[model samples]
Target chain A: MPGKVVRVRRHSNFGWKERLYLPMIFVGLGVTARHFFENFWGYMIGKVKTFVVQYPEERLDYADAFRGHPVLVALESGAPKCVACGLCEFACPTDCITILPDETRSAIERIPKVFDIDMSRCMFCGLCEEACPEEAIVMSRDVELATYDREAMLFHKEDLLRTEEQLGRRIGFIREEYNRA
Target chain B: MSDLLQAIEEKLGDAVEDSHAYRGDDTILVSHDRVLEVMQTLKDDSSFRFNMLIDLTAVDYLGRDPRFEVVYHLGSVEVEARGSEPSSLRHRLRVKSGVAEVPCEIDSVTSIWPAANWMEREVFDFYGIRFKGHDDMRRILLYEEFQGHPLRKDYPKERRQPLIGPRN
Candidate 1:
């Protein structure tokens, strides 16, 4: 059976009320004013809570599960915890991690001479963190990683180091969640 | 053997080379030449109404006889009860057929199910396993200029290919 093709003209002409747009504008303003007054009264009486946080002044405390940027853990003696195994580099799907292992005179014989992570290409999948046997490389809570230059985004070993105290919550969470010692 | 595999075996005796049910999965290794016939029967037969072709892909087993195995996942919606409100049940079947390394070809199931069109193209793209009688058999995922099948076991994972097009 042949199908019917109905030809119809597009309605381009607008109604008088739509063309004026005065009622719609006032309606939008009314909605905004209602919200403002409700929030104002609620704030004055301390009955309701506001969710808006002043950026740069007030920051949200991220959860332990929050995966932001990958960083290397540093011990209290000012030495990296990494053994330069290159497991994180291998686990990285984007090939954003680069490491150069060299022999060290420290307790851990092996250490990464040069470790670089390209933040621009990082997807923050946390596969590297899971693959780390020594728990050296971990996902930090540092979300504000914006930079002007591409070279600045390539974080070296020194720049990627974070003290154990700073990453205690995340380490504890990972150990507890993953059932690791 | 599961009921599905036994039924398929009884229906297409000679066509089914081997069949097994492992970990609640019904897998049947069909003869490469008669795969299309077996697939058609599975779809048409009332006992096993596999109306949906869930996925079609290929696995390259290097250092093995019949180097490639084309896998097809078929799903069927079965009426569980005969009551007024018929509850539907889902059954899945895995169909595998081995293809030789030298020729590396298999009859396309596109005629039985149209969804096999792009899927066969993808298998051909990744494993270089050509689907015979498939019209417009071209690369689906990778570009035409791609050197070799990247998914093959022998293909180096870290081997970097020269960048295509002009770069500043």
Candidate 2:
């Protein structure tokens, strides 16, 4: 269907109501005034609830399924839980993840000597999290990752690492998802 | 053998190399040389008017002798409004033809259904399977300077190309 051309009708002539503009303008203003009055009255009575959070001052808790960005799960010892299997790297469609596996003296046998994720290239599709065999990589609620510097966006292994406690919600959600599947 | 497949086989005869109704999907394997003729017949045939070209793609079997197989999914819509007993029926058929590795080209169905234009281009882009008689054949997904067909089994997955255009 990609080759099919859909012709949408464009209205060049404005109707009398649109051309007059004053009546429609009043209608729009009436809508605004209605909302303002309703909100003001509700606020005065302290019965109205708001959808907006005070952003920086008050952070809204994201749901467990809300995928923000990929992060490496770290153990209590500060070492990454990842064994450098490279499944996540391979699963990444955008090739944003880069990993260099090295022999580790730990029982895991291997660890990523260098792991970098170019945030600019990362689409936050959570394919890396799904492909992780050890559940070492997961999507965290770290949505506010805007940076002024391009270099800052290229997150190193250290920058991507989050402790188990910090990622408890996501881990639980993943476990539940896998269990259901 | 489905009735549809039987009809197709009877209509096309020697052009149809093999056919099967594997699972529920009715598929007919046609000779690459006679693909355009087969497609035209399928589209124009009154009993099996496959008016819509649903999907067009190619598969690469690395070790296979032919190496590439272009697949086409054709769909037909039927409206049976006979004296208040109104009903609509739909039928689907899969057509596949093997293309040799040396001359990896197959006849384009674009002349019959214009929807095959970009799909043929995409097949050409990723699998390096050119569609014969396709106008303005160029890379659909990748850049023009892209070295190899990425979907080909022989193409290295991790192979990175030099940055083109400008580097910020």
Candidate 3:
């Protein structure tokens, strides 16, 4: 049996002058300079520059319908709006909401005595807010809810229930959504 | 039971307390105490060789009799070689970790299935369930200094004091 062998091809070698490598260096510099100039021009014209909000100093405005942390509402009569029907508790898939009943209020049925919401466990499905029959619970736009301690994440009734005065500018948007047909 | 599953059931008789087949997917509910034996037999037996352990986790059904149920989803990659159709097997072992302090020890399946290490760690991190023979059991998601398991049903929502200083 006969075996076949393949021969390799060799290109022409560069001279001493060509091997100095000044041409390659110039080509590399030209490519880098072109990139630098393009980026600089685009940035100067404000085309490539990003317009991200600085957050703490300059925050991005959230939409009127942006459901965030569920807040307990207070009635105009200076009482808690939550009737403690346990609907919110039942609606919560994670079972983060725990409501303890109070017998003081007659009209509101039961008020949350030790209402605790584990924020860490909350998937924020917005079911609790939607399940509220009395419109007592609403998700706040304030999303900066970072906590150092796990225990700190447990939000009680007092912490979740926002007073009318403390509603801030976000409340106006919420009110607009509430009033919308 | 499908022909393959029936063969498995026949091979591992009495080991499986109850088996559920839904939507062509088979889930065998094994007792917690015999989980190790069941897993060992499933791996060793030629008919139903469940070599791969997919995931392990715990569910806190607070109001139920068994407050905590550790769910283990096992898969058999070697089914194709044993003249059985290729299908993943899920085995959920319900460990009744009682309401207050349920002290029940289920043998670690990690000895046979090495992949159970991370899954068991995750279960421990979230539900506070301990795997007896686990080499390194520590919090995976939360910091080491972090208090109670957040996934537990009783984890509190609010803090006594505000996380930050009062608004200016």
Candidate 4:
């Protein structure tokens, strides 16, 4: 079957008002008015606004469950809470944790000679902290861990181990609990 | 096991350096350059129709000559009977390549397996291994201004402490 071709007639000229450019001007004005009204209404209702937290002055409060950097706890007698059992290191899937053993006077067998937590490789799974039987290693709330050098991100025993005096002034309820603990 | 390895050997020939079938699972080690060709053959060939890429990652053998080995786990989903367990047979292929400051970009498999997008991005993000034709090749987790690749072996963990305060 062959397809049929149809011919169409073309209009010669625009109407009086269309030729005068009034309709075109009205369409342009309508578009401009619509945008202006929308923006004006948004501004009046404070919808089209930018609100940002002053990060330096207004710090965010993290929830109690927020697992941040892992911390090594210190005993009441100023000794590290780690028994140097190497359980945390073994439990770490990424092998980011490294611990060295040292003899301590207390009955608590071995102390970590050198505890290193590679924050770079650490997946922040909280597995190491959970594997700690001595309640020594814990994920702290101090999450501001921006660093320039790769070397600086690998935290050693001294860097991760937190002391009561070092925690400074308490700001939230968790700080009070940490102090009490 | 020998039959499958022999089939791969026949198809890929010299490209695959070594082939090992462990407990009905095949693992073929090949050179970095030949990975794309091998993958394409596996996908197109009738015997081994590995249409899906399960995982793609890189392992940094820091001391080895070709320091990086990109591992690809390929599989095809096979439907089972209603009462039976659905199974998938996966083949792991490791391609050895040089890892230096000059980035090593592998031919991306996202065209074959769309799921490789995030996995490749993750590998690139953590290991700094580049995928040549990735649509958006940017850091997934880390901030844009982040400095060094943290997963590299030499990255230190101590110097991040503030000078005046006690280290946390």
Tens digits of per-residue lDDT, candidate 1, A1-181, equal 4344454688589777667899878988999898988888898999655668788898878776999899999978777889889999999999999999999787899888999999999999999999999989999988788988999999999999999899998898788887845
Task: Quote the lDDT for A122 in model 2.
Answer: 98
| Per-residue accuracy of model 2 over A116-153 as CA lDDT, tens digit each | 99999999999998889999999999888888999999
Candidate 3 Cα misplacement greater than 4 A, ranges: A1-43, A46-48, A68-125, A143-181, B14-18, B22-25, B29-38, B44-47, B57-71, B78-108, B117-168
For B71-160, candidate 1 gives per-residue lDDT tens digits of: 999998654654444435568999999999889899999998999999999999889999998997999998777888899888999878
Sorted by DockQ (best first), the order is 2, 3, 4, 1
Report lDDT (CA) for all predictions: 0.88, 0.89, 0.71, 0.74
Candidate 4 lDDT over residue span B1-168, tens digit each: 577678888988899887787776677887766677888888888788787787787877777766677788777555443333335454444333344445566777787778889888887887788887789888888655556666666666543622354435
- In terms of TM-score, the best-performing candidate is 1
What is the lDDT, from 0 to 100, of the residue B127 in candidate 2? 94
1 against 4, candidate with superior TM-score: 1
Fnat scores for every prediction:
0.00, 0.00, 0.00, 0.00
Interface-residue RMSD per candidate? 16.3, 12.9, 21.1, 26.2
lDDT of 4 by residue, A1-181 (tens): 4344344577668788779898889999999898888878877998963345579897768765677777888877777888989889989989998988999677887899999988888878888866777767877777778899999988988788677554332223334554542
* Candidate 2 global TM-score: 0.73
Q: Rank the candidates by lDDT, best first.
A: 2, 1, 4, 3
Expressed as tens digits, the lDDT of each residue in B1-168 for candidate 2 is 888888888988999999888899999998899999999999898989998999999999989978889999999965544444433446899999999998888888889999999999999999999888999799989988899999999998889997898645
TM-scores for chain A over all candidates: 0.77, 0.80, 0.64, 0.61
RMSD of each: 7.8, 6.0, 11.6, 14.3
